[model samples]
Target: MHIKYTISVIFIVTLVIIEKENNIISKVSDKLSTQLTPILFGPSLSAPHNASADQHEDRLLENSTWSTQQSSSPASASGGQKHILLLATTRTGSSFVGEFFNQHGSNMFYLFEPLWHVERMLSVESGGTNASVAGPAYRDVLHQLFLCEFSLLESFIEPAPQDHVTASLFRRESSQSLCEDPVCTPFVRKGFERYHCRVRRCGPLNLTLAAQSCKQKEHHAIKSVRVRQLETLRPLAEDPRLDMKFIQLVRDPRAVLASRMVAFSSKYKIWKRWAVGEDLPVDEDEVRKLKGNCDNIRMSAEIGLKQPPWLRGRYMLVRYEDIARFPMHKATEMYSFIGIPFSATVEEWIQHNTQASKEVSGVYSTQKNSSEQVEKWRFNIPFKLVQLVQQVCGPTMTLFGYKFAENKDMLMNKSVSLIEERTFL
Candidate 1:
């Protein structure tokens, strides 16, 4: 009798929430159903480091029971802005996961990569792209960004120059939306050089107005590949004035390294250490990518675990494999963490976009057959490189609960040996 009553209460709460979201979703799409099936009504959930291994305690629930009353944000509770950060390195599927929120949260104002603007400024001053951002500097920028202030970015920010790999990071929609500045809105939409849409009609760009134009938003999110440590973000994470949450995306290091190798060559430090005019190697810089990838996540998680009590319930760490393998279930948990309701519109969007295909896609596109993405590294990469990443990133991987295959030696054939072969324990 008690279980029945509890289920009935949950069902009633879900209906009320659906009724609210439908009002918004209905206006946008004719295709989404007015009523979602009962499947979206699972109990609320939080990040699971490793359910089988019991690495971290379940912060929300094993099952979901959706209710708007349950979604908590210090910002919302105190009448301030709510900020969500997508924290991950490149090739970790942060883009795809970010798009999940971008598409689902209709009220959300998205900022794709505010840090890239900072990175650009740093690159100019230092004469290269291979430099790490100072934590304090990064945090100061983020604090203003969370509050919807875009003025600082105007100094070095411009429309993406061309259709390059990181172009999606500077997409105009996010740039325009995150700022409340009247100048920013028009500059990104028209005045920018690369996307010269209505150049003849626009006057001289008032960049100062652009700098100050970030509008405070109800739901503000920014996804970036620039932040290298959780500690760098410690200030905002601990700020009493701001309500912030994090979605930390993790992928198998083998897959990360493989993707990086495909994307960049050794002369390819995306400006991490490219001081002045120094000549960088023109080889596959797997070693540099591997170390940075492993160290950042390992160190970030370690620092996050040791964060102050106030930071609890601020982070949801999800593996790319988990989401790819179980899209509906994982995306539901992700949305739950972000305080967004999972409606049929969101479900339908995922279904429509993720249809499997043979065509290789870039990270920027929201349309991906994500399940296939999880295992592509297995076939695309050679065993020698796999063995190398596994060796170098082994301990870090273990901390994140990523297991190895049974046939470890198969990663290397007789023909291809690692630069330094270390025996696996």
Candidate 2:
């Protein structure tokens, strides 16, 4: 009877121990699930809390530790060590390039037309007292606006909680059934919340915060379409603290003319219908003349050559054709040239983001009268037009590797006979 009782006791004890271990594992798994769900779904964590209080507390602690790690680690903090500034004319793929950078986890702050503000200031400063009655007041208002915008953008990036989750996931992934830890949850949630809040607070100031925070580990990337003009960038480049590198992007004149026509036609229609009385359509000949002027490209090249040899290497000339045909390779080369480590994530991001669109086709004549399109100037223009361009811009074009067609008959016959009559003159 005593042996029977001992055997029964031993069986019961074994059963109880096994049950206890199972419960402990179940609790750990539940806690882990709570912590990791947010990361897996990415902004989709909406489940009701079912974990024990202890588990919740543990998750918060894990999160705090992860946050600390992200903040301390240079790689997690700053993405890279270069500030990239993209300079290009309208419809020249500046935005596309900026989007590419943004995908690479680079914080790309965009200024659609920063030059408009500069022009407004210049008009007021130059006109002085003779300026319009509203000029001085407008200038003061613009000054305040510019100051606020610049201040806001100065410190844009920050360390976030979700960054921890991403970092943790990046650190390890396994199939042996691991549960989320409570300690990691709070930090991820907090980081995500902060990021959302910053994005909502748009403008230069908010951008600055995000940028500065990210800069703690990575470099800064800026894309402002308005900085296309050389005069606009000169002052910025002169700033001692702003170590700006320029990437001047250009496209073939034929393509640019087509894009420009679309842009101008839209703008002209808007102005005619809303801001001003009806006006005649833009002269296709005049548009062609203006587009053919390679002044901006020449200026960019001059700037590149004029820089100290050290800085010359910093300026890269990106042709739009090269970007469209070989985005990944070009992007990698660009990042390398700028001394930033190329992230495979960034390459993936660009591929996912820049699926070719209709606008990228560089075709503006289809919707309009194809026969009357501005790009057809190559056919309509007399030989004199090509001769004029060659005479004035041939040397610069040659320096930039643009080969002039040897067939003088092909170019000379299309030259503008009434070149002096063109408005661009």
Candidate 3:
């Protein structure tokens, strides 16, 4: 009996040692495979071997930890449904990024700037930002929309959605999801149905139909610039009915201001006035407003990056510069983060849109020679304003890897890269 007990103990110990060795070997093999494989998504052009920063940038793009682990399967809520919010401010290339999901497939229901109406309604009686009444109002509307409840939205729509139907839905045509099928006129040619709403020749959008479409979709995404703070969205993220994820998109403040100047010339008339070599008062109202905006952006980003309990595995930070430089690559990362397959249809759209034969210009047009668009502002914005922006938005810029320009010459030199390669998460 003693001999048998000794033999059994030896056998058990042997099995334990083998199991430990197997685990170590498996982990090492995975690490080696990951290192050896080329990044799944990266720029078409390779950087010089000697350029360490460029090499680091490529690696950063490859290793984004949007979810706990990268997998081929989609990470979704309990019911196989997902909700995504593309959080960005004006002129931050959100519309361009939003299109990635918009073109995703029949499974995605994308809403473009649905919160524009809420902002417009409250702009007249605004009491500054945080104190403004629009804060809770914006959140409430978004909460309802995520649930496919449109009655709250109808309250804000101009001309009112009578019995939950109206033609005045803000930017209705931009959303292909709203432009097709039961919501849009069915008689139009199949291929052209997406563009039918652009002409407004179709009948009004029935809120009932829109809600039905939203419910039928497997996933939903909304792109909005209205929500100012990340913490304010905690309620939506914690809601049991929704599986919410946020992609906070930011751009270099200098580029944003430069783009806005051209896009909203009338609103930025004061900026143009200061562009003629006049001295800028950093303490003035315009400058203070710019500073405040930067503060808000940086603070919100800080909160998201901290990965608070409600946001863990649900928050992603993306820079517009990275996307502009490598649209398809960044789009792949985003879709992966949201636990969705990056479709070839989105790939084709990026190819066509980013490499336009000629420069297509519009205040809101997504088409551009993407790489060229990143530095276009370096030539357009005066050095004085650039300096002012850096003074006010320095922390935000530094956090997102935007390097400061030492002088006007360095700012204009296309070879001296202003964006650094930094990894978040």
Candidate 4:
């Protein structure tokens, strides 16, 4: 009996030792598999090899860490949604980028320039940008909008379209959605139907219900030119409830200056529409205009540099140059950062929309001649004006890493390369 007990105990001990060895072997095998995967595979068969492609790849690699990453599978990404704001100025391609999002967002609702109401309602001009009285008031209205509360959209305590949510900023998309059950006359055709079933409007009014019903959406976005200051929205960014992210869209000021100077027609006075004050001169002197645009951009960048730690992944700077050059890549990056799938519909929209509509941009026509458009500012703006703009905007320009053209000839003779953007590091 003693011999039998000893044998049994020995068998149990042998089994325990075997199990321990197997656990170590399995762990080591996993370690080897993980370490070897990147090496044994070489780069996946899909990496690009062209000279320009290599350059672009390097650019993307450089900026990869800036785009905030969150778990992006359908379940986590889509269900949570986000409130995205394009913190941009007019003529910076804000409209173009906004349109891109509105079309492809699928589950997202976009507002063109909701703040136009804040100014008209409070009788403040130019978005009340300074932290003075109107500025704070504007922010309060903005806060309410971001929260998906549309009660504020109702006409002011007294009824008036001028002071209502349907004020100047409503734009075609919002205006059309106001068409009620019977559908209002002077209908808006810019996808007004998104609100039809849910809107149930009357006298083209009753949009409060539709706007408040935004809780079900995967995302809500607003594109505004009124917001030139980045820090102005700190309250929203810090709020865990707002779930907001911002994209700072910047364009070459030279290009921006040239685009504004293009002769305006009654049909496409897009630049004039950027005005804030009702009494602000329609045609400000070119020098003053250049200064204003440059200052706004310069300030935005400087402010971004001073952003607090909480905003690290929340604020992203996107260059029109990069978007123009690699629309697909940039779109994919932008959509991913916003927590949405860059679906095939987005791809198809891009393929068809590469030719920007002639109506908005005029001669520059969104035809998207890509690299060529970068040089247009050089050729379109007189050599003298270009030099002056460079002089007036030099420090601000350098702050954002925009290298000036050595000479007008260099604009064409020299190949232009864009410096990605200012790096906080």
Candidate 5:
């Protein structure tokens, strides 16, 4: 009995000692974690190291939830006028997205494709084209536009806009601000719905009145696909007169190609032939052209996503897929990023356009059942072409959270979403 009692005491004492040691070790570990956390997860680090892998993952998910990272620069916080540039490539659903800001309110001045004239005039003058050669002109025009200077724009207008008055202002009806009374002859007609700009001829746009209207507005926004490189716009972004924000909109390259094939059929004749199962000469000039477009888009996105010093707080990367799926939500987040109120006018327009029951016709129509529009390209384009685009644009697709399908069956499977849930800031 004495030996058994002694054994019990030893066992109990051993367990107590072990528990105390464990408690001490746990306390020490927690203290180390607290002390090292700042160093591990400081501003110097883009992300926390492997020690906080779970935390890092959570942060990525949070960022991907359509939120903008706050800018480190003091200029971003400074208040006055706001300039928003909805930067995108052709056939990337930029027109529809631009409507978000366009419909903000009467207080917002929105311009649709002002760069249209620049590209047109320059393309004619050069007898061909070179975006690099025209980069300075593009920057100057954009800078002036932000400051409500319309005289520079008049120079680009064909027939030379007699004293800043011209009927040929390149889709003047597309802009609600330009279409409204005082800037044009008659006011917007009653029961005049959005996307019916074609039906309501607002007459000639007066550049003087338009500039006056722009100055009266609290904020200004412009949508353009012509600016080939984000890096080229550094000067405009850093311009002291304007507080600028750039939202870089991207779409799956496959979808862009499919949309462009139909929209610019003349230009994409080669692609249409490929869509019909013709042998895609991957080495041909057409193929190289497609590859070059993809490279330019990807390079611009990289510059924006990297958040260079000039573009730090000003740059935002958004996927058309995300916006299409959740138009109002994404628009709200976008407005928040730009520090604007998500007005009811914008919300009502989004609901009307995105949830349309009938198919809206027009190559450049912003109205559509956006959810269906997101996947419509899959049926329109062939698997072979999809493979080619993926090959050329694989890095871009991966960077923007697009997933690849292994086969045609997988490509047609709508149940399997190709958009991986990832964020680009």
Candidate 6:
């Protein structure tokens, strides 16, 4: 009887040890996977390492629901001026538009693709993109990150009482709590603290400490530019502290397709699947032909129309052609729409920094002068393809005041003759 009792005790002890080991192994595996996996958005692409691994980990911990602290300080909350966010497909001149605003001396800042951070974080948490399918948890995580980034910005500009108190009393306290997750905590804290130091002396107790806590000057603006994460932006629009304007940039679909073919082939490979005839690798030739197709332009227009109405008036559709023809006028109009005064300095900057003059059919190189390249699509594309594009995207083209060749055959014949004449000359 004694031997049987001893054997039962040993069995129970072994089971507990095995269970504990399994839990530890599971946690270690999760951390390793999160570290090793590549972050992806739309397709596989690398994200800028804006923060250190330790900062990222801390950000995650701080963002966890169980980790948050109740607000201990009171600060007045009020609405502020609306921030303008530019949204568009790649190669549609969104960057140029953003640069125009940046030169206009508005408090505006340009961010390349801010939503990538949230997407990467969610992917890590969910194990992969497949697991992050459209769901409540995915939506919630996205929303939280958006809100946290925005709130961090607000704390910098106008520190809440809690922020003020925290910065002053516990100067070493982690600012990662301000962000939804701890991943970006150190970066945020360092940035804000730097800003605070610039204006005032650093110490254990003051509003200046809060202001200097931000690491990046444009943290708020940068966080706002992630258009793919529109769902996150929606709730933020309601906050009185934030006034939001969305500028949806639309271009001829052919131009968009052509540009994407060159610029985003690796990032958006699915585009290659849409190609017809000869199974051509999405190369420069296909990009050029596609650029002149009206159907491609129409598809882009459809995308614009499908967006919410509140986003429409806030959006001003600019044609690549018009921008090329009247750069100053379009620039002026854009500034006015965004409620910023245009200046001679802005004009000079546009002339100096513009990429409208450079030519590359389907490829976008970061080294190319963008302002000079803006309207070069007209010279390289074939007339027949242009007509086909006009035929397909006629309604939208007409709506946007795009002029089409009166006779498709005549235009093609003229183009061919001109090419021959140039060759002979």
**lDDT of the candidates, in the order given:** 0.58, 0.44, 0.78, 0.57, 0.78, 0.43
lDDT of 2 by residue, 176-264 (tens): 00112211122222222211211122111222332234334344555544332443444233323234467877654534444554567
Tens digits of per-residue lDDT for model 1, 108-135: 6676776767676555544544433334
Q: What is the lDDT of candidate 6?
A: 0.43
Residue-level lDDT tens digits of model 6 in 1-425: 99999999999999986675555445434533443333211122233479677766655454332212211110122123335566555677665565555454423333334344333444454444332132222233233222222322222122333544433212122122122122123333232442232222343233233234322222222222234434434433333233444455556654555566567668535444443323434456544545434444444445444556423334455665556546777888866765556777679877765443345322432223544454445544445445656655667556555456566454434343211111000
Q: Which residue segments of model 3 deviate by more than 4 Å?
A: 1-78, 125-131, 186-196, 199-201, 279-283
Candidate 4: misplaced stretches above 4 Å?
1-79, 120-131, 153-169, 174-205, 263-289, 305-307, 356-372, 412-425
The regions of model 2 sitting more than 4 angstroms off are 1-80, 106-149, 152-217, 228-240, 266-293, 306-310, 353-396, 403-425
Cα lDDT for residue 112, candidate 2: 32
Pairs with steric clashes in candidate 3: none
Provide the lDDT at 98 for model 3.
92
Model 2 — which ten-residue stretch has the worst lDDT?
A: 170-179
Model 5 ranges off by over 4 Å: 1-79, 186-201
- Please identify which of the two predictions, 3 or 6, would achieve the higher lDDT against the true structure: 3
**Model 5, C-alpha of 71: deviation from truth (Å):** 12
Question: Residue 18, candidate 3: how far off, in angstroms?
Answer: 74
TM per prediction: 0.64, 0.46, 0.78, 0.63, 0.78, 0.46
lDDT score of residue 145 within candidate 4: 62
What is the alpha-carbon lDDT of model 1 when measured against the actual structure? 0.58
Q: How close is candidate 2 to the true structure, as a TM-score?
A: 0.46
